[model samples]
Target: MTAPIVTRDEPVAGTPMLDARLVVDRGAFRLDLALRISAGEVVALLGPNGAGKTTALRTLAGLTPLHDGYVTLDGQDLDRPDLSRWTATERRPIGVVFQDYLLFPHLTALDNVAFGPRRHGLDRQRARAVASDWLGRMGLAEHARRKPRQLSGGQAQRVALARALAVNPALLLLDEPLAALDARTRLDTRAQLQRHLAAHPGATLLVTHDPLDALVLADRLVIVEQGRVVQEGDAATITAQPRTDYVARLVGLNLHRGRADGHTVRVNADFSLTSGDRHDGEVFVAYPPSAVALYPRRPDGSPRNVWPATITGIQRHGDNLRVQLGGPIDVVADITPAAAAHLHLGAGQPLWAAVKATETRVYPAAPGGSHPE
Candidate 1:
């Protein structure tokens, strides 16, 4: 989608593109984070709200100062609080596309893209030339003369991205770059963004809570919660083995931590589950909600993990009904709409939930980590 956006010579891969640690103490909230990104790589900081995903982006861009730790990018020190070394946002070889796009209301898209280069010492004529090429590359040449108010959300977003890349930044930071668009626009823009990012040889950090964005745009995922990293890994690995309830829910899996002895894992004093895989000591178990089956009465045959649960909520999930069950274990169950009707599913209804052992996956939990809530 953005295959032609490389009109200006993009920077070649730089060694040690990003090596940083950031610490921000805000009296009530503190963030201590360390991260690294090589040239031509995209790393996503994924987490729930107030998890400090955007704060990390700001730290790397030098919009927020580090209380401790340092930010070294492409062999340059951007932040080293102890040494009183911190580069201002504009001075750093970084570009940030904020959640809101933040385009100038009165400026034409062309001028908006040219603003950065103009400020960075390029003459008006040359700046406009660069902007013109970028707008054309982004498939926005026709909209180049439109003011921010006249342009569509996706068009404005393209202009914002062009402006950021005009200076050939060594580090690219994006904060929910697609949040303002509609679902359709988001899908299209996301694909366009992926192409642009792939063309960028610099290190890219994307801050978002959307799992799809991280899965599609980033080469690696770093999940943060309460201002600390809970897990960091590739999409497939992290998706298969989430470390926290938040991560599990984000990835659409039911996960529980417990003590494992053989194929059985005790989730709590009141509940236990058997897994196809065996483990010892602390362990984690996960299963897809679709694997859960609801019965009006206790089943009479077949090996099953059965428990009594009260329906706390019910909603449509695509073609299935999502049943929120609360009992010894809190978990979501997906059932065909016809099955839900056959069982007369309703909030507060009593039902038996079962999952086959073969559907459950077991893995070792962090050695000393506490169980996730």
Candidate 2:
């Protein structure tokens, strides 16, 4: 009998499951992102709307043509603009699950899952058997006869996933896989998707705008904006040190850019910072919303970074209230409702914001740091 596909880590020399140096142009938008994914690894491409996250994914899957650069999978060149080499989407060993879960409405779940294998030249009976096994693994065996229209959003998503996997792709691409589901269904579907991805031995690239999705489903995150990679690392590192305001907002941190002179950093001409650590160069200073303390008036104290600020807006964020304050620099502070009531904080209220020197962290800005809008 043929050996069962090994799911455990097996070193494959010079075998990066997915590698791309993609540069594509569309009118005014430009995407230049370099990405690499190893066998059994899941990487999430995250960014705001129109940030070229989807474009990058499509480029790798051979669905979108490259304006320049190349894509390689399992050491095979999929695209090389200079050499005039290009692989059609169907020829590339990649499977894509779209945001809408593009299943044939008339096809039964089993038939839908079997479609890929059949297209790949499997006999009808063999494809059906493989499809049945996949549906069984996904706990949808009882619903195999149900049409796509009869399935719930989550069930349809599972069917799409099964169809993609039945092809046994060398690289799996999921574009906003959980985006179309309701919150309740999304949570459940996300858990299921994670389990399946964990068991898949090939590289997976998930494209998402949701930070929660990236954190839970991916081994690493590649934050792209305007078609370029802004920051990339494991989840924890990205959360702690977000390089751009866009990333900071996604991860819920207050990010600032400034020029550092010893312990003091100047943010714009009007705002400056004094940190406990000394450095001399451009740097990024970041802190959580909770690190900021607001007062109705300038309190008489020895606080080093107290600045006069005005409440520009107030909104609820999760369990806490996020107060947007504007001064020499913009900042966000999270406070309890009681604190808001105690301080009589409201939109247009003048206040003082303070951050201890020790609470601020400074790090060298990455090359081509947060892009200018």
Candidate 3:
């Protein structure tokens, strides 16, 4: 059996890379998020648009001022509102790659990457030498002399990453680094990026909306909603138990809040679910969409959880079809194409959805939930 995943509030072992409470206020919106990353660890920051993801990144990069709290990197105070201390962006030991791979259009790939080392006080010849080595490591040595416009999208992204890494920064910030590539290019680049990220010894923070990127590239995930941290944990723990609607959808799980009594959980006034686990008080019930089985009519079986549902929508999910059902309790179920054909699935089609008690997982709703550090 797998042990339960612990919360992020406790201190992380080993040397700390970036540790700070980011507090930035913009009119009605306020971003109050505490973030910590250990050396050689990559943490992914995921959230919907307007969830303060960009604000948090900007604050860390020194592009935006903090309304409160402080920014500490490598045991140095970069920003502290109480002490009235601020570090200029260039003076900070940090590197950032923007969404567009903001490389200088006129500069060659080699020169573009060398720019960072030059800014950090490296001489021209030495900076170019370091840049050439990095470009070789990224498998772009052949495109060293090509201009940004001449390079492909994936090539440009690699050059941008090499530039950021050439500075040997204490903290590396990536803001939607792979958002601009096409599907096929993104796949190839994602693998390359993962290798480079693993090699980086500095603390890394990746801000992205793609779940696949977070799962593959990050050591831990921090999910934010409404300018606050909602959940933070490893990929396995997060996928197994989601605490909020946004997180549930992010991980492709059906989640519900309810009061648990032994094996049964009362989700609402009209609906209740039975789980294999026994827990008391307010709890969260979660299961994968694949766990839900749909039948054209009520089957003659002792299924512990069954409900009458109407198909609200249907969409292709990979090789299978994802059916959205709405009734007493809204849920999503994944069925093979053959099963869909057998059930004649369509929007507004009525059916029965059932889940075995053994498939459900329950956990506390609040005490184990995310809290501000």
Candidate 4:
């Protein structure tokens, strides 16, 4: 087995900033995910719990041993199973920010940020100077002397980020970066983190379960389910046509399986829908929660597709109400608070739901098929 040498700055067509064909087997659980990230691009790995999002990150960071396949960063072969070559975590040009914001309790903010550079063999003075600059960039210059316990959650996160970036790695990995912050602090920290990530020249992979985080922070999204990539696309594309129930629930949409003939799609034998676009064969039909109109009994107006649905659950979504309905086809509807009050909407309430043909979209499912959740 010989190590494959990868030359940087050698232009290759369609070459990504970081390319990894990772396969890790751990007893019953196996992760086989292929990922690519362009330079300066941020790709968010979104999935539910136990979906292997963290496992993928760890494999890329060399924290988890690869059972097969290879990892290439900036064209360098970090790991290659065929060659029996593997780079140690410290040797890999990557930075990682854990969920808990792992900061030394005894070290100050500056010292925490300096630790990486110092370990990389930089002089103490130079490392501190680099750390100071990062702290300044994160707007934590005033708290450089503060310890982990002394700093707020948001502040500590920033310090952790600065520490990771101070080493100037080729790839940055963040695992649930905002999971530790409070609601108010999370919002503020998200914006701040976005700004810093925007300026980073290296590729970044953010692992988060939050849809808002993926939509706001990522240029593209990669949704994994049960150790497989279920969907990968831009926010608009993924949001408009979620490939799984988890994604549909995240984006607040009713997703259904149907067979399409032109613009009409039939679902559940009894229910058929007219979509905005024309398509044939097996398809997916999706409509946003807001597109559904609920009626107390039955409306007098023209209704193409109206189904008698029973409210299965109700919750507040932003300024509106998210009502989950069950019938021939399960659906979620978003109605205004006033409408909800007027209709006396609650769990187990009977209602009729209507959606405009133009509001619905139908497209062919992916080649491998839709995600089963």
For TM-score, the strongest prediction is: 2
For model 4, the run of ten residues with the poorest summed lDDT: 1-10
Query: Judged by lDDT against the true structure, how good is candidate 1?
Result: 0.88
Q: Which tens-of-lDDT digit does each residue in 1-373 have in candidate 2?
A: 2122223346375657777899998879988888889988999999999999888888888888999989988777899999999888877777889999899988999999998888777778988999999999999999999999999999999999999998877789999999999999999999999999998888999999999999999999999888888888899988988899899999989999889999999989888988989988888999889989998888787778999999999999888899999988899999999899899987888899999889888987755534334
Answer with 1 or 3, whichever has the higher lDDT.
Answer: 3
CA deviation > 4 Å runs, candidate 2: 1-11, 367-373
Q: Write the per-residue lDDT of candidate 1 for residues 17-115, one digit (tens) a residue.
A: 889887899989988777889888899999999999888898998888899999998787988988998788878877889898999988899999998
lDDT of 1 at 64: 86
Give every collision pair in model 2.
none
lDDT of each: 0.88, 0.88, 0.90, 0.87
Taking all chains together, each candidate's TM-score versus the true structure is 0.94, 0.94, 0.93, 0.91
Ranking by TM-score: 2, 1, 3, 4
Please give, for residues 1-373, the per-residue lDDT of candidate 3 as tens digits. 2111112242246647798899988879989999999988999999988899989999999999999999998777999999999998888888898999899998999999999887767779998999999999999999999999999999999999999998887789999999999999999999999999999878899999898999999999999887899899999988887888888998899999999999889999989999998899999999999999999889878789999999999999999999999999999999999999999887898899999999988888877547522
lDDT of 4: 0.87
**Model 4 alpha-carbon miss at residue 249, Å:** 1.6
Clashes of each: 0, 0, 0, 0
Distance from true location, Cα of 106 in model 3, Å = 1.8
Winner on TM-score between 2 and 3 is 2
Clashing pairs in 1: none
RMSD, candidate 2, Å: 3.0
